[model samples]
Target: MAEFTFSTEQQELRKAVRRFAADNFDEETVRRLMESDPRFDPKVWARLGAELGVLGLAVPESAGGVGGTLVDQAVAVEELGAALACGPLFGTVYLAIPALVAASAGAARDELLPELIEGRKTAAFAVADQAGAFDPAAVTLTATDGDVTVSGTVARVVDADAADVILVAANGSGGVGLYAVDAAAAQRTNLVTLDLTRPQADLEFASAPAQLIAGPDEAERVITHALQVGSVLLAVEQVGASQHLLDIAVEYAKTRLQFGRPIGSFQAVKHRLADLLVDVEHARSTAYHAVWALTDGSDDPALAASIAQATCSAAFSRVARDAIQTLGGIGFTWEHQAHLYFKRATTDAALLGSAEQHRDRVAKLVLDTAAVERVPEVAVGSPR
Candidate 1:
């Protein structure tokens, strides 16, 4: 993989996003979020939607999206990650956007994509089950064609209650399929989650009418592609959280005095911080490769996605744990923000198969390729 340097335009956008995040997403505001029911601040979400035009970044320009590639979405996600912005931007912009684009057509794409871009319509991608697995084949929700409806229940759906459109993965006799379910058409039940910053809900499709956006076999492919998008964007977010953890650690090391010297100046603390920098930088390289591969519409997108997911998952865990350690006693307290980053990393990592799972996938790819390239041995070395 080559070193990634953002384009001049991307760099400028990064600066803009940074400024926007700094101005809006402060510690106090995040603290207030802990008290809210939905966890996300709608005002902040609308600002990102209207002012930043984030939801449209990955959607086609024709459909009212920014007409940018997945790489562009990764850039925006990095900024949001840095701020630890508590919103459904990740769910809408990165996860749901691509799935909808792949599955919907005609009026669906033309109508909904634009609304999603403008933040007029909130959307969520429903794939994961209660077990934390994102495999669409494991989807127990059945969409049966009845007199007036297709009905089923989807559990552990992210941002389902708040969304207007849901891209659902359903299984039937035909196999896996994708359906665009109107949230209003189904009975939505709100649910509590460990991560308050991101709300979740259960979607009960009690004979609800739905449009079949994708065929049965295509559903898994679409879901996998969406998960790929989610994995890379989540990597960008992990980068943000990791970068912030580094910042917190550095600040604490410099300001906090121990034994008449700054803790940051201590060799042990310095080395640990250096190690963190290496992890974050390496994760950045893998993430950039994944994003580039995905946006380029290359043949090896899945391999790249696995690499990014594997690398970033480990990087996030390292940065979060080290951030807490560097803060010593204060880090363990709920008053500090270290726990927030820690929780976010864990939540994001657990969403799309853990680091180990992705690593195994990458390993399997390598093994399969090697097996295909192997040649039969000659008997007693008598023949070539």
Candidate 2:
């Protein structure tokens, strides 16, 4: 087993996030958000975004950020997942900002990055159609005349209503490109989504004007960055959900008696819970590796990301289902909150890309790298 160690700063950040989530984003707040029309409480979001500076964690110092890395952001993601809060922070901060930072340079980045760091503007990655195929080549949206006109609709975008800017991936002259579209110019139709807590929308661009932020090849560049960051961050969130599920299951097992004693004392329950612990720990190692690679500029960030996403997705889903089973009848009730975590876990597992997709990518990457190693270098006239 790999050992886990955290720096003092990382530990402090995690503690602060845990306290904030526990205080503000409890079960009652989550229920209220789910029931409400717009979905989240603005005050709580402001506190998280503006007060705590959660949105700026991954942004660089040149862009007015605190100069933190993906690992720092991952720590906060865990807390947010644990709370099950309904906010646009993840979509804006994790997906959009990272993509922008990775893709743009010069004047555009100078103008956009600072605004994002300050939380004055919100951005979303407008990938993924109704089919949930997040491929760059699968994008049906079109951007013509270099940057002037954009057409086609993007389905199921996270936090589309709150966005000031949207990073749109579309088919352009030289292959797939990324454009920074001003949200006010486009037509946004809010959708009745399954996960009500997280607001989603369908956006239409009828020859909408956009700025050419990233030229051709930008879609792959930006999506790769988004996936690399999201894969690890999503795993952190899964860690939080899995831990929360375990805690809930343990408490329920202790209080709810079966066969005259606490059900937790049963060998079957004990073994199952023990197995869950092992899965969670395994996920922790892979997630930590992914974050570390992203932060340290490792050679294989994408491969690390695929491994983490695949492992963490499985761990979270299993933990969530087992938790529901452990709670028996009450877990199935709408009033009970176990189902909320379960649903969120399911949705998040399929975000960015599915676990099966990631596994396939991982396999190809490994084989490709192995094949590259078989070719021997020849010195001018020396070796064949």
Candidate 3:
């Protein structure tokens, strides 16, 4: 409803999160975590739940949460991405929780939301098809007589190994629906991803016992809405990462000397950094608009989300690349932190949907809306 500018309270929240991240997720800490299997500290996750109230930021108060808005969640995620915070927080907050909230009110929401909000349980949404599409019709899991089974492997299942429960999309006799499956019931193998900070897994389900959360009529709409939410929040994360990379590049240019002069003084370096600054600011605006659309129940959330994804995804990737170039050879070294952001940018650009896919979505929406608008004119011009 309101403009995208952050309120005083929101600014304070962002500042607090940035401070927390600086203390806990420094470069040394990130490097150490990457060397570990889980790639995230349980203590840090616990602190996020206990101190930051991040787990429940988007959940409703009736569901045992803090009753925060999507914008609030976006603010938190932006800071987390800037800090390169590693954990299952994104999958839980952006995907799993949203799916539960979108489902028809039932035992699933009642029993699961509380645990999720309290961070006692973590969940991942297993909706992406083999080819990485998030379409409900793309779901390969089958269900019959209240039992759901998935045989084929689902790829890029974020945080699957760490999740206690998985909210799976499946097609049943009743049609498409959301199903809850315990992690132990499914076989999981961690996949080696370019971004080690955010691990993924391939899950195999064989006749896994599952409870239906929403039936065919509501399944597609619910899943699509959840995805839009994820996309918007993910765009916010990209903006944060882009801003951080820009900051790193500019600082390096100022300090690093070339031929007895600061590299920042060079016209080439200044132009590159200036271009990156414009892109990052544009991406931030797009992400914020999408967040506002979601929070305010705008008529065209799909359009808003697709635009944000299409714009921010490419913007972040480009910024990351340019940042690395600005820093010279050191940016390419594994020991340097620039590579981490580059990997994250590449991975995140393909996380939910690629930039090309989102651009297609935007094109379709615009054309469809234009067609609808033309119908009125066509009818008025015709003899009646």
Candidate 4:
């Protein structure tokens, strides 16, 4: 594949988003939103959809979207992460929309896509089981006679309470499939999580009426594709946050004084900051590669996504940890914003799949492909 670099337009879009976040997502605003119910500001969310066209970045124009690519979505998400903005955008754009697009053509896609693209409706994916596994077999919800019921609790559902619509993975007579459930039909309990900025909820469904999007034959494929897209896009968000933390650390090092000299002049601090910069750059490159692979559909997207997820998650965690260390005592206090970024980094590392899981996936894909390549070729009618 060709080299990956953001286009001039994409670059401009990133700058615009960064400026918007700086103006709107200040520290006080973020803190207040974290403490508030729903954990996201409706007015800010609406403004983002209307002014920046963020809600439709990857949706097709026919579906009332901007007709943009996955790369565009990644660009926007990166800026959101950098600003530490909290909202339902991640669940809506990264998870729900992708699931919708991957499903078979039907009213679910036709009716909901426009609403989602126009930001008239919000959606969440109920794929994670109580153990937080994304496996279809892990889903305990049952579907019968076109009515899906989820008796067991779905833990760590991102933005469930805020969603108007929910795409649930359930076991039906046809097999595993995607079902659309109205949020009102389900019982939702907001849960206090490590990262309060990105809130999660527990959902219990008792015979909740639903519309099937994709049946057993195609449900697994659709859910897997959605997850892959989400992982790749989430890596971009990690890169943005990692880069921001690094910048903050470096800036603080330059101003923080000790022994009548700036802390940045100390070799130990300089080395730490330099290492973090390198890691951030590495994460950026990996995330961009995955974005490009998904956008062009020219490479092994699964492998690219796994690599991005593993590398970016670990890198972001390390950057956040070192950023706190670099900031000294103030970084540890509850008031410092470094803790927020650190908490987000740690929580997000395990949100979709942990770093270890993605790394194992990478190893399996590489070894499996190699095993296939190494198999001996049989001469015509010789072995038999």
CA lDDT scores, all candidates in order: 0.74, 0.76, 0.80, 0.82
Question: What shift in Å separates residue 208 of candidate 2 from its native position after superposition?
Answer: 1.5
lDDT of 1 at 64: 67
Candidate 3 RMSD computed on C-alpha atoms after optimal superposition onto the true structure: 5.4
| After superposition, candidate 2 runs with Cα above 4 Å error | 1-4, 129-134, 217-219, 368-384
Cα lDDT over the full model 2: 0.76
lDDT of 4 by residue, 1-384 (tens): 356778899999999999989988989999999898878887778777877898778776766678888888899999999989978866888888877876767976789877776667788988863212257768868886654554445777888868999888888877888888899998999888899887778898888888888888888777777777888888999999999999999999999999999999999999999999999999999998888777666556667888999999999999999999999999999999999999999988887788898888788778856443332211100111
Cand. 1 TM to true fold: 0.89
Tens digits of per-residue lDDT, candidate 1, 1-384, equal 555578887888888888988887887787677567666767677777788887667766666667776777788889888878877765687677766666546555566666777777778877664222256656756777732245677776777767888877776567777777788887888887666666778888877776666677566656666667777778888887788889899999999999999998989999999999999999988887778767765425557777888899899998999989999999999889898888888877877778888888788767766444333211111112
lDDT string, candidate 2, 190-241, tens digits: 8776666677788998888877666775557566666567668778888888
Candidate rank order under TM-score? 4, 3, 2, 1
Question: In terms of lDDT, which candidate is stronger, 2 or 3?
Answer: 3
Off by over 4 Å in 3: 129-134, 148-152, 369-384
Worst 10 residues of 4 by lDDT: 375-384
Alpha-carbon RMSD, each predicted model: 6.9, 5.4, 5.4, 5.8
**Cα-lDDT of candidate 3:** 0.80
TM-score of 3: 0.92
